[model samples]
Target: MSTKKISIGSKPTAKPVQPSADEWVEHRGNGNGPEPMKRLTIDIPESLHRTIKAQCAMRGTKIADEVRELLLQKYVKS
Candidate 1:
């Protein structure tokens, strides 16, 4: 019996594909009157995420809506 050698090396990665700004806006708009909303992402603890999700479900609300309201209250000041 002969032993075979194994080669392990980093694989070449393909560049991430991103949509053009016009494409992104068109896709997001979908004829919805040109909403100018921007997307954001945040990292949170898993437990906190679960709690917020559960509370929103119970209140028949959306996580985005809750976050948007909190942001508006804090910064918009109107």
Candidate 2:
């Protein structure tokens, strides 16, 4: 005979928690620069996004391509 325990009202979940803006900025600069950004809906500042778009245009590439290239150069290479 064997006895096992497996009773719970609700199993614990490991949902990710969001950080405050200040924490986010600091955390992003911690050599890793925030985890890979998801390709979902986001509310980036218009000015920042516009600047990125301009850079993409100057580089003759799409915004996503520019971002990917920058990430590889800045993060992966390091």
Candidate 3:
């Protein structure tokens, strides 16, 4: 009688290569795609910061999203 043997365990495969910066921009720059986000830094009173944090926690939303909504409402007119 003859028997065949098969390999049981094998090494993991390598991860796929990441895209280059230029490729990333080209892939994401389509007109219908979302606009790239920009970072903003500001200094505010500690109390105001605390209030904003608390409000966001109570509303279950991020401070950044809340601020963006407020800014759009205040400055963007239809």
Candidate 4:
């Protein structure tokens, strides 16, 4: 579902060359001021998510933002 180029028999096959940033934005939202970040609805087991939600609430942030922050800090900080 994501872009990763591949070579095919002495030729490169790129996935419909990416549009420029502004063009991508315009195309995605159909000229309606760009769409918000795509939201995903997942079904995680409550047992695991309960602790996750509690920590997010304690830190006063959305679960997505909190998770992103924690992951970036933990994984990308090295």
Off by over 4 Å in 4: 1-36, 70-78
Cα lDDT of model 3 overall? 0.91
Give candidate 3's error at residue 57 in angstroms.
0.4
For residues 6-47, write the lDDT of model 1, one tens digit per residue: 999898798899999988967876775965788999999999
Task: List ranges where model 1 is wrong by over 4 Å.
Answer: 1-35
lDDT of all predictions: 0.92, 0.79, 0.91, 0.79
Task: Write down the lDDT that model 2 would get.
Answer: 0.79
Q: How do the residues 1-78 of candidate 2 rate in per-residue lDDT, one tens digit apiece? A: 999999777877988888989999777756856655657356899999999888878888898776677778987854
TM-score of every candidate: 0.57, 0.38, 0.60, 0.40
RMSD of 2: 12.6
Order the candidates by TM-score, highest first — what do you get?
Answer: 3, 1, 4, 2
Better of 1 and 4 by lDDT: 1
The candidate with the higher TM-score, 1 or 2, is 1
TM-score of 1: 0.57
- How far in Å is the alpha carbon of 44 misplaced in model 4? 0.9
| Model 1: lDDT of residue 49 | 98
lDDT of 4 by residue, 36-68 (tens): 665657798998899898987898889998766
Off by over 4 Å in 2: 1-43
Best of the two (1, 3) by TM-score: 3
